[model samples]
Target: MEPGTARIAVDLLGGDDAPAVVVDGALRAVRADPDLHLLLVGPTEVAAAVTDALTPVQRARITVRPVHAAAGPAHHAPRADSTVRAAVAAVRDGTADALVSAGSTGATVSAAALGFGRWDDVRHPALVATLPAVSGPVVLLDVGGSLEPRPATLARHALLGAAYAAVAHAVAAPRVGLLSVGTEAGKGDRPRKAADPLLAAATLPCGARYVGLVEGYDLSIGARADVVVTDGFTGNVLLKAIEGAYAMAGGPPEIGGAPRAAALLGVAGTVVVCHGAAEPADVASGIALAAHLWRRRATDRVRALLAGAPAHSSPSDSIDTEVSP
Candidate 1:
């Protein structure tokens, strides 16, 4: 309703906690952003509970699309009438500007790709998350996108990550790095070794340059490389490890901590995927993330940038690796 309003579709059945956590998070996001609108997609009673919590004026911004489907765990492939698909449809039908779901990562990714379509020439859809680093923020990719990305896949992620840092975080001429066991070019496994040369020669948009191999420490400290590239297996493991480390050391730093939510890049629409075990606060943040992405038109810009970026290799050169959502 407001000039900068962002209508986000909430998958009420998505998340480990389901309707309750989703409801609580929707309430939090609506109260936090007056310009934010929500389309609650789930059972009527759940949607009612969300609307009931808001004031009359606030309720005006809420829209409800009652869906009837038993949402299985996140790992369950989406059923035909699942809430996540309904949420995606809302965005595609212009009822919402973005979508946020804590459902199974794979389900969300599949639904999004099928609904929004992957950008032409995109080998795989990438999940990107920004973590608070000692120096600043570090953008990490394939947090759950392509798990066993080949050299070409990593190269593609490098370009996507670089463009994201420049557009979403405003990092200028970002330094890009491939995550490896050591800083030496030949230190990593076969994937890393093979990917190194490909990334070295790839052309990154927005003045970004490849910084060669970066150790895992570089991901947290942010002293080197604005963008850290890795397969989802390593990236996801590293992300949880960093989160655990931060948890052990009192709490996350004030500058903002590792986000539990990640933006699904390479999709045609704005979609934010929260950790399946996301708490209410995490869900709220996911909603906020969706709104921010939609408001900034980050997805469209990233796609446009990818369109202009020179191909590192032909589609045949990359293998479509499946990592968990």
Candidate 2:
């Protein structure tokens, strides 16, 4: 376990079976890591149940912040007034080192981006996930953070994925690849076509090289590309399909399936997003992931790397605080 106290604010009402799964996951995390503390954001009664279930010594490591919003509540709510918004505020206020939520992806991203602010030139932050590979770990980005992909955005994601692999996963030299239907240069749709040369021309960090293109199998087996980059729409669907395939294959490979939780990149603070349908184990992993990201200072390190990189095209014109419904 890490030494410093990693205070993670968890959204107790975020998942489909929230409060129960959140409580169970929080308990598991607390018991597994002695130095970890949690700021539970949700109903007070639910938080109390978690505390009551813990031993006296263990109870001391938890803190409950109520997000009791009466019916028909207005805007300008307090941080401890909404489960996900509360978690975001906890990080912004320095009360928590990181945050984990299995809530609405759009809502959580909007709250985090509005509360924590986006890094320079990052229009829409990407939901990045790392897959355990035989060679090393593979980093996949834009897993539903943004659906539309511009050529420049794909190039920028390459830089982000390369830096993240180096900083968070400790991959010395990462190989970045554009996700496409075929490995050939002219294989994908218009976006892939536009992005191919852009990624080729881009200067990647951490000694990373841009491999032309990789197929869907590359994502599962990890034979090609240590980092797979694509638009959030495609990445999200592909991730779920891979997970389903693993389920159909009896179970995930011994190596592991595509992760259900993803790390939000381009934000100022460490944030993790679990699948909206996450169960107890998935929630626990989300918390564990937040702790891992906080310890690694993944967000800060990635931002610093991008600050020094060459200029990309302008950020997306739409900077709306509210995400698409």
Candidate 3:
């Protein structure tokens, strides 16, 4: 809260390559931002690597919460007190302002929602990501929240995406779109068919307007919409597909393509989700995003905006779990 002194709790054992990549990312983030402090949550040894790699002055900025393990074999249920849970607890307990993890999407979301609580009426929280574009920045949401999709949820996400685009990216009047197979009026499957009208009817924040349905290419080019809303299942696959496309196209375009890092919306505290397959740079960007979010207080502002808006037209009862969170 001190201007730029953003304290972030990093999950040391949350990823496929836990400890190593997570440790490396922590080192990179620490070296890049002098004002950043990290609360490393995991085994004592893993935390030591991050602490030991830094200069004495840098090491002073880090704190470790060692999580001892049981003697028995671990079960599927997240260790009752693992690094990810500790990271979430740190945010909830005011030990840290935000958290960053390249962990299981569902585990992170569940832990954050349980620890910090969700905003009123947010049944299914969304994972939102921003992509830098030539013209400006674009906000995409429901990347991996829940799958299958309800018309109402998609519409609600449109509102979330618009506010994020305006607040985080500083776009004047974002043009929102529903991702589909084509830009035509009736170009997608059943869910898109139902959600298109819902989005059209929904009220958006920050002077955003719905631009109708857009295609996958639109996401890469950012030519159709500044805020693209979709179901978590489709959005997740689409984001990965775009990343793969860029890899095939000899790296992302100059402005960049789909991002591996996403912001968790609806939870009270700031949480960043990095792809399970993130590289050191991707993890660094995730840390930067968590810092930017905590510095801007994006979570609080977005919740405030949602509080002031009228109830969404769609029902909020169904919680789609297919999208992960």
Candidate 4:
């Protein structure tokens, strides 16, 4: 392996078009990065397809862990022996620096939480996505990680987003905002109203400051805030809607389109969750993202930052009743 190499464990059977799309994507990733090493966790035959496509020097960088069981469908929970779980195990066992899966988001999140263990103060792990904006990248949290986050969870996510923006994207003194129906303090439902003051009062890491409430338009324009926090259900719906809007407009902005992948935060190890319907290029991008995070040691830095952030008190009985999109 080359120096500074990043070994990424890939779930070959994690996507809608498993094995085939994965093989193509793995090939693309390996060819694109000289310092990238992939541990394919899936059936032997499927793993062979990827290695067979590579030259002798390239094949030297590929490894395989034969896991026959695939994490099929979002409804079914991931089995202990599932490919996604095996990939997580590889990371836990120090065989891979990071893991990438295009499988069920719940299954991946569950397996990662089990294998890597959650941060002590974090109850609900957040999935953070970065969207290219007019000014710069905007970090949005809970795209699908915590569907019904309590007020405390949202506050915790604010700290996560702030640290992530600084560590992952090099944003200095990121401006953080809570996603609400309007920019006013009194707008939004029960959860938003309750969480607003908590975020404003909370001590954010990386010199981040709470910028009160922001409207939906700020997510793309990113002029108001660098980090946008929201419940998973709404964030997920908004992400897809923006992606669809980009498609309708002929193509995405010159900066880039909506990300089809997101990094899982609050877990002890590096893990990336890709869109279930991810194509080859999207899968390749996910792998690249895993490599990037591992190289930057983002997970460790974010955790360290969170450790220094002050804890906030929230009502345990608080609940959000918003419908999923």
TM-score of 3: 0.91
| Tens-place lDDT digits, model 2, residues 110-203 | 7888889998777789999877767777889889988887777788899999999999888888889999989988999877888888889888
lDDT string for model 4 (1-325, tens) is: 1247999999999988887888998999999999999999999999999999999999999999999998766666689889999999999999999999998899999899989999877766899999999999999998989888567778888999999999999999999999999997799988888889888888899999999999899999999999999999989999999999999999998999999999999899999999988989989999998998888899999999998877543443344344545
TM-score of candidate 2 relative to the true fold: 0.92
- The ten-residue window of minimal lDDT in model 2 covers 69-78
Give residue 82's error in model 2 in angstroms: 1.3
Candidate 3: which stretches are off by over 4 Å? 1-3, 68-77, 312-325
lDDT tens per residue, model 3, 146-262: 676777788788888888887777778899999998888998987788788777877788898999998776776688899989889888888888788888989898877779899
What is the model-wide C-alpha lDDT for candidate 3?
0.82
Rank candidates, TM-score, best first.
4, 1, 2, 3
Candidate 1 ranges beyond 4 A from true positions: 1-3, 70-76, 312-325
Candidate 3's error at 131, in angstroms?
Answer: 2.2
Deviation (Å) of 29 in candidate 1: 0.7
Q: Looking at model 1, report the run of 10 residues with the lowest lDDT sum.
A: 315-324
> Residue 248 lDDT in model 1?
94
| Tens digit of per-residue lDDT, candidate 1, span 112-183 | 988999898765699999998877789999898867757778888999999999988889999999999899
Highest-lDDT candidate? 4
Score residue 202 of candidate 1 by CA lDDT.
86
Q: Per-candidate TM vs. native? A: 0.94, 0.92, 0.91, 0.94
